[model samples]
Target: MIPANFTYHKASSVQDAIALSQKLGEEAKYMSGGHSLLPMMKLRFATPEHIIDISKIDGLSYIKEEGEILRIGALTTQSEMEYNTLLRRDYPIFMDAIKLTADPSVRNAGTIGGNIAHGDAANDQPALMLAMRATIIAEGTEGQKVIPIDDFFHGFYMTALEPSDVLVEIQLPKKKKGSGGAYHKVERKVGDYATAGVAVHVVLDDSGICQEIGIGLTNVSAAPMRLDRGEAVLKGKKITDDLIAQVGTIASEDSEPTSDLRGSEAYKRSILNTITQRMIRLAIERAQH
Candidate 1:
C-alpha cells in the first residue's frame, strides 16, 4: 500500500523541524528512520498531509556519557546501540532488548526516538527504558523540556510530546555497583512482536539484599509499564523462592492484557508470571557476581 499524497520538508535542525510541525499543525508528522510512521501511513492508519523529515538533521545520532548519566541521541539506531562498546559493557540490558527487536534490516534503520515516540506497547525500547529509569528530552518552539520515562508514555500511540515537539535525547542514569539487568520475551518468531516481554534491573547491596529493582512489562498493557508493585516486593529483600513467586504473582495480577493474535488473556498473563520470575532471578544472579 502506498501512502496518500503528502508534502515533504527536510529539516536541517531541530528548531526547523519544530517550525515545520507548528506551521503544518496536527496534520504533520515528523519522520526519522520512517520505520513506524511510514508503515502506518502506507496502511492508511496514518495520513499526514506533510512529512517533516528530521533524519538529515546533524548531531542527532550519537551515544555518550554525560556526568553520571548516559545521554543517547534520539536518532541513534537500534543496531548502533546494540554494538556500542560503552552500553554493551555497562548496560547489557539495552543490548538484550535491541538485539531482539525486529530483524537486522529493521534494526539498521529504526531509531530509538521513533520506537518510543510511536508509543506502541509492542515496541521493545520503552520497556527497557522504564527498567533503566530513563528520561526523555523534548525540543520545541518553546524550548526544551525534560520528561521522566514513566511519565512520557501516556497511552496507546500517545505520549507527552506535543505535536510540534521533537524528542532530541534519551537520558539514562548510570547504574550503581552490583547492578545487573536482563530482558526476555516470548515471540512467535524472529523479528515478531512479543506475546509477552519483560525487563528487569536489579542492584544488590553488600549483604546480598535487593537494594533497588525495576521490572518493566511489554505487550501486557496498553503502554509499557513498570511493575512498581512487583519491584516493591523485591526491594530491600533477599531473593527467595517464595519472594520470587510473590513478585511473579504481583506482576501477573497487575498486568492488563487483551486477547489477540499473540495469545489469550490468560495465556499472556501466565507467560508474564513465568518470565517475570525468570528475569528477576537472572538479574539477581548477575548482580551477585
Candidate 2:
C-alpha cells in the first residue's frame, strides 16, 4: 500500500526542522532515517500532512566520548554503531543488540534516535538505553531539554518528545573500570523481533560486590521495562548464583508479555527468566576482566 499524500519539506538545520514542525503543528512528522515513520505511513497508521526531512541535517552523526559521558548523535546509524571502535571497546552491549537488529541493509539506514523515538518495545535500542541509564537530548524552539531514559517512554508508540521537539543526542556514562554490560534476546529467526530480550549492565567492585546494576526487558510489556526489583536484589551485595537466580525469577514474574506471533506470554516469561540470568552472568564476567 502507498502512503497517504504528504507535502515534503527538507530541513536545512535542526532549528529549521523545529520551526517547520511548530508551524505544521500536529500535522507534520519529522523524518530522520525514515525507517520507522515510512512504514507506518505506508500502512496508513500515520498520515501526516507534512514530512520535515531532517536526514540531511548536518552535525548529527557521530560517536564520541567527552569527559564523563559517551555521546551519540541522533542521526547515527545502527551500522555506524556496530563498527565503531569506541563502542566495541567500551560498550559491547550495543554490539550485541545491533548485530541482531534487522539485516545489514536496514541497519545501514536505521537511526538510533528513530529507534527510541518510535516508542516501539519491539525495537532494540530502547531497552539498551534503559539498561545504560542513558539521557535523551531534544531540541525545540525554546531550547534543549535533557530527558532521563526512565522518564522517556510513556506508553505504546508514545514518548516524552513534544510535537515540535527533535531528538538530538543520546548520552551514556563513559565506561568506567569494573563496569560491563551485555544484551541477549531469544528470536525465532534472524532479524526477527525478540520473543524476549534482556539487557544487563553491572559495575562490580574489586572484591566482587555488585556496586551498580541495571536490567531492562524488551518485547515483554506495553513499554520497555526496567527491572528495578531485580537490580535492588543484586546492588550493594556480593553477587551470588543464588541471587542471580532470584533476579531471573523476579524478571519472569515482573515482565508483562502478551501472547502473539512471537510466542505465548508464559513462553516469553520463561525466556526472559533464563536470559536475565545469562546476561547478568556475562556482564559480571566482563566487569571482572
Candidate 3:
C-alpha cells in the first residue's frame, strides 16, 4: 500500500520544523528517519496532509558526555550507538538492546528520538530510557523543556510531545563508578517485537548494598512499564536470592499483558518474571566489578 497524497516540506533546522508544523496545523507531522511514520502512513493509520522532513536538519546527531550528563542528540542513529566506544565501555545495556533491535539496516536509519517519540511499547529504546532514568529535551515555539522519562509516555502511540514540538535530545546521568545496567527480551525470532522484555540498571555500594535501581518492562502493557514495585524491593538493600525471587513475582503481577500473537498473557508474564530476575542479577554482577 502507498501513503495517501501529502505535501512535503524540508526543514532546515529545529525551529523551521516547529514553525512548519505550527503553520500547517494539526494535519502536519514531523518526520526524521521516517522508520516509524512512513509505515503508519502507508497503512493509512496516519494520513497527515503535510510531512515536515527534519532529516536534513543539522546539529541533531551526536553522542557525548558533558559534565554530569551523557547527552545524545535526537537524530543519532541506532547504529551509531551500537558501535560507540563510550557506550560499549560504560553502557552494555544499550548494546544488548541494540543488537536485538530489528536488523542492521533498520538500525542504520532508526533514530533514538524517533524510537522514543513514536511511543510504541514494542520499540526497544523506551524501556532502556526508563531503566536509565533518562530525560527528554523538547523544543517548541516557547523554547525547550526537560521532561522526565517517567512522564514522557502518556499512553499507546502517545507522548508528552506537542504537535509543534520536536524532540531534540536525550540526557542520562553519567555512569557512576558502581553503576551497571542490562537489557534482555524473549522474542519468537530475530528482529521480532519482544514477547516480553526487561531492562535493569543498578548501583551497588562497595559492600554490595544496592544503592539505586530501575526496572523497566516492554510490550507487556499499554505503554512501556517501569517496574516500580520491583525496584523498591531491591533498592537500599543487599541484593539476595530471596529478594530477587520476590521482585520477579512482583514484576509478573504488575505487568498487564494481553493474549496475542506474542503469547498468552500468562505466558508473557512468566517470561517477564524470568527476565526481570535474570537482568537484575546481571546488572548487579556488572556493578560489583
Candidate 4:
C-alpha cells in the first residue's frame, strides 16, 4: 500500500529537528531509522504531512561512558549496541534482548532511540530499558528534560515525548558489580515479536538474599510492564524454588495479555511464568559469580 504523499526535510541538528516539528505541528513526524513510522505510514495507520529526517544529524550516534553513567545516543542502532565492545563487556542483557529484536537487516537500520520513541509494547528494548532503569533525554522548544524509564511510557504506542520534542539519548547507571542480567523471549518465528518476553536484573548480597531485582515483561500488557509483584516477592529474600514459583504465579496473574495470532492470554501468561522462572535462575547464577 502506498502511503499518503508527504514532504521531507533533512535535519542537520537536534534543534533543527525540533524546530521543524514545531513549525509543522502535529502533522510532522521526526524520523530516525523509519522502521516504525514507515511501516505505519505504508499501512495508512499514520498519515503525517511531513517527515523531518534526523538520521543525518551527526553526534547522535555514539555510545560512551560518562562518570558513573553509560550514555547511548538515540540513533545508535541495535547492531551497534549488540556488538559494542564496552556494552558487550558490561551489559550482556542488552545483547540478549537485541538478539531477538529483529533480523540483521532490520537491526542494521533500526535505531535504539526509535525503539523506545515508538512506544510499541512488543518492542524488546523498552522492557530492557525499564529493567535496566534507563533514562531518556528529550529536547524540545522549551529545552531538554530527562524522563525516567518508569515515567517515559504512557500507553500503547504512546510516550512522554511531545510533538516538538526529539528523543536524543538514553543513559543508565553503569552496570553494578555482582549484578546478573538476562533476557528470555518466546516468539512464533525468527524476527517476530515475543508472544511473551522477560528481562531480569538481579543483585545478590553475600547471604544470597536478593538485594535488588528488576523484572520487565513484554507483549503482555498495554504497556511494557516493570513487574513490581515479582520484585516484591524476590527482593530481600533468598530465592527458593517455592519463591521462584510464587514469582511465576505473580507474573501469570499480573500480566494483561489478549488473545492474538501468536497466543491466547492464558498461553502467553503461561509462557511468561516459564520465562520468568528461567530468567530468575540465570540471573541468580550470574549474580553469584
- Candidate 3 weakest lDDT stretch, 10 residues: 280-289
In model 1, state the lDDT of residue 76. Answer: 95
Alpha-carbon RMSD to native, per candidate:
1.1, 0.8, 0.8, 1.1
Judged by whole-model lDDT over C-alpha atoms, candidate 3 comes out at 0.93
Least lDDT summed over 10 consecutive residues: which range in candidate 2? Answer: 203-212
Enumerate residue pairs that collide in model 4.
Answer: none
In Å, residue 81's CA in model 3 sits off its true spot by 0.8
- Badly placed stretches (over 4 Å) of model 4 are none
By TM-score, how accurate is candidate 2? 0.98
How close is every model to the real structure, measured as TM-score? Answer: 0.97, 0.98, 0.98, 0.97
lDDT of 2 by residue, 57-175 (tens): 99999999999999999999999999999999888999999999988999999999999998999888999999989999999888999999999999998899999999999999899
lDDT of 3 by residue, 1-289 (tens): 8999999999999999998998999999988889889999999999999999987899999999999999999999999999999999998999999999888998899899999999999898999999999999999989998999999999998899999999999999899888999999999999989999999999888888999899988899998989999999998999999999999999999999999998999999898889999999899888877
lDDT measured at residue 262 in model 3 versus the true structure, 0 to 100: 83
Name the TM-score of candidate 3.
0.98
Q: Write the per-residue lDDT of candidate 1 for residues 1-289, one digit (tens) a residue.
A: 8899999999999988998888889999999999989999999999999999998999999999878888999999998988899988888788789878998889999999999999999998888888878899999888998999888999988999999999999998776678899999999988889999999999889988988888889888998899989888888898899999998988889999999998999999999999999998888877777
Who is ahead in TM-score, 1 or 2?
2
Query: To one decimal, what is the Cα RMSD in angstroms of model 4 from the true structure?
Result: 1.1
| Local distance difference test, candidate 4 | 0.90
